[model samples]
Structure formats: C-alpha cells, structure tokens
Target: MYIEFFVNVTSKAWALPILSSLHAGIPGRQATLLTATGASRTSFAQSMEHLIELGLLERNPGHGHPLRPEFRLTEFGKESAAIAHKINSVSQGEDQDLLRRAWTLPVLASLHTPGHFNDIRRSLLTITDRALSQSLKSMESRNWVHRSVNVDARPPRPIYSAINTGGRICQITAPEISFMQR
Candidate 1:
C-alpha cells in the first residue's frame, strides 16, 4: 500500500514539489505555494487538484478569497508529505529533473534490495517493459543505479541496484513500502 501510495502521489509532475513545500512549512495559499514550487499555473493547478482528489490535500475553508484559496494537508497528506519532503531534500541539481518523472521514485523504491528485470516488473505491476528499461538506463547514466550482470544465471541476467543518492532514498522509503504478494 505504501509503494502504491507513492505511485499515486507521484502521478502528477508537481505533486512531490507541492507536497514537499507544504511539509517544509511554506504557507498553503495558492500564490505562496505556486511561487515556492516554481510550477507553472496550469500544471500546478492540475497537481493541486489531483492531490485534493487523492485526499492528500484540501482547501482551507475559511482562508483567502475563492480565486486564491488556501490549502491544507489532510492527515494522510501530512504522512505522504513528510516522505515527499525527505525525497525533495536529498535530490539535488540535475537529479531534480529525473526525480520529477512519474516512474522514477516508485522504481527506485522497488530497487531497495536490488532486483532483476522481471523482479522489478513484478513489483510494479503497472510499469511496461520499455518504461522500466528506459528508466533504468536513465538512472544508470546518472550513477543513481548500479547494474551488474549475474554470470551464474543461465542466461546472464542484469541485476539493478540503487546506489548513492538513490540508495539513500531507497533506504529512507523502501522500509516503509509494503510489497504486494505475488
């Protein structure tokens, strides 16, 4: 459920940033969050609506004009926001762009213990082979993931593991993500 939570929450490009900023104590008014997240108006609105739909956020009923309403985190939102804040804190510079991708964090979360292609695909039921392959290759080029061949395997399979910043994030998140039974 925890891993799935990330999968849902990260569906929007600005979700993590918005959650992170709110968790960091930035005011939840639209203008403040918009400026802090540096998200464009349309994407930011979409992300905010998505969060609200997910029950992670809700408008503060008594605050601000309707056109520029304030928002607040629900209890679930707070929990998820804490995780988002942790992820946001560790990501730096170029990594920021990669982390914003829909599949990246969920994929990294599954890499906590290192897995083969099939293992990862099984863990994330919704990911396509090509998407997983592309995400792994991209992270590999960034040095966030380490890929090694298992020569002992009959077909010589490639194993993937999170390293460095990716490893740290995995350590932080994977323990909390409940893996679904096969």
Candidate 2:
C-alpha cells in the first residue's frame, strides 16, 4: 500500500535496491551496488539507519568491528519483508494501475477526522511534508478525498476529508475488507 501512495520512484529505487541486494544474504559488501544504482546515497544510508533502528536488521558482534559491523536481517525483519512483498503483490491484482496509489494507516486516520491534516501528520510522525503534499494531490486527483485550503494566517494550510466511508479503514483508498481478502 505504501508503494501506491509514494510513487515518487525515488523512494522505490531507494528501498527495493537495498532489499534486492540483501535478498540472498546478510552482511554482504553491498555498498558498491547502492552507489552504482544512482540511488541517493544519503537517503539509502539514512534508510539503513532507520531500518536498523526499527530492529529489522542487526549488526553482529565479537568478530565485527564497531565502525564496520556485519549486518543481518532479524527473523522479524525477514518475515515482515516477505509479508509486505506478498501483500503488495496481492493488492495490485491483475490490472496493477490502482497499486500505484497505495495508502498508509496514518493517511487513513487523518481522513477520519475529516478536516485536520495537521493533527493527522502529528499523529502519524516521520511523514515528510513533500510526501504528504504529493499524497494529497494524488488522493484528490483520484477523487478519493476532498481538500479545503485555509490561508487566513502566515502559512497557508489545507484540510482533507474523505468522500466515502464504506469499507474505509483509516483512509478511503485502503478499504477495510482488503486485508481479509488478502
């Protein structure tokens, strides 16, 4: 679902490449491929840090040096990635077009309030402003949501609301039944 919402390609390029590199083994000398793909080195590095912090990956100890640690996927990490890939494949269905606009839980929760993007973002932490803006535009284009811009103050803000609630979970695009179907 995240893939559909964040179709920037850059994000995919950043994530998939690293995942593919680690597909066969862990603690591989994979930095070269990360550099060769023209992926944002900084973003890729940051993601590694974030993924590690998430406890999905871990560095081995003893033989491993502190600065140059060997990494491996935790059981939870591998299972989660596997489940994500499988679910993502299922969500695309045969047409696959709808798959590009995946929705996240926070985005759905934001729509629940109907007119509080700020509150939604605060509730959803770590979502970048650029990503939120891009997602709002995408959601509006799809007619899945409605937006009202408020510019009475120094910095303008927009509030988003869902148009339909049937089968909706947090966001309209992410229907509640979709999980059961999976």
Candidate 3:
C-alpha cells in the first residue's frame, strides 16, 4: 500500500533529500548525492543502500570503479522521484515548512479519507499518538487538513479530512503508493 511506501521512503532521514537531489539534476553518484544532500558519509551510504534495496536505485554495472558505483533511478525509482518532486511543488508557506518534518506526508495521505485520530494513527503504524496529534494540529493550522467534531456520537469524536490542497498532494503522490504496491 501507499502507506507502506510512504513509510519506507521516509524511514530514513536522508531518503527524501537524496531522492530530491537526484531528481533535481544532481548526478546519480555517491559523491553527488552526498554533496547535494549534505548527508554525512555514513548516512549517505546507508540511505543509498536502502534505496538500492528498495529497488528505487540501480548501480550502473559498467560505470565507475567497483568500490564507487554510479547509480541511476530505476523505472520505479523515477516514478517515485517524480512523485516526490510533485509533493514538494504542491506545498507552500507553512504547508511547505510542515512537509519538511517526518511523518507529515503520511499523515496527509492517511487523511485522504476522513478518519478519526485512532484511524490515522493505525494507518501510520509506527507514529506515536503525540507525533500524530502534533502533525495534525500543524496541518490544521496550515489549512491542509480540516478537523470537525462528531457531536452526534455519545462521546464527541474528532474527524480529520484532507482539504482540496491536501487532496491535490495525495493525488500527486499516488504513484508512489502504486509503485510500491507493485
């Protein structure tokens, strides 16, 4: 599912930045990703290995020294990178600032359909209640998510939904979900 893909890509702090750098015209080499993303050597190596393991990146068999492989985005990686590009483009101002934080995209994606706090938390799997609450509040402030109270219930329940702008982000990132599902 897209949530799984979202988690996979975001699990590493440097993953998005590496993908963004590559998509932004940086060469697909360790040195380039490292320089562009400003990731420490260890983090860069780990992130590159993770991306390669996830099938998002493939090393060029004939290029570079064996110890320093030149990488390129696979078809799946290209699709994922494109979606990342769109996500970056769709966000602005506070929304853009929020997207820089971990779990922001996944939270927005989870709210594609209206969900209660528990539902969104369940979708994210690894997110803590506090983190989810903070993310949702930040998104609410940015107008990316709308929260409403279900007073009709015995106990009022809060429901969260993606606004049109949030929906646009989810739509743009849909390919990542499909790509990972494959």
Best by TM-score: 1
Report lDDT (Cα) of residue 55, candidate 2.
59
Global lDDT scores for all candidate models: 0.89, 0.49, 0.80
- Estimate the TM-score of every prediction: 0.95, 0.42, 0.80
Note the clash tally of each candidate.
0, 6, 0
**Residue-wise lDDT of candidate 3 within 50-136, one digit each (tens)?**
889999899988998888889989988887887777777676644555665778788887876789999999888899999999988
Model 3: worst 10 consecutive residues (lDDT sum): 91-100
Clashes of 3: 0
Clash pairs, model 3 backbone: none
Runs in model 1 with CA error above 4 Å? 178-182
lDDT preference between candidates 1 and 3, better one: 1
Q: Which sequence of candidate numbers ranks them by lDDT, best first?
A: 1, 3, 2
Between candidates 1 and 2, the TM-score winner: 1
Off by over 4 Å in 2: 1-28, 32-38, 60-70, 87-134, 139-182
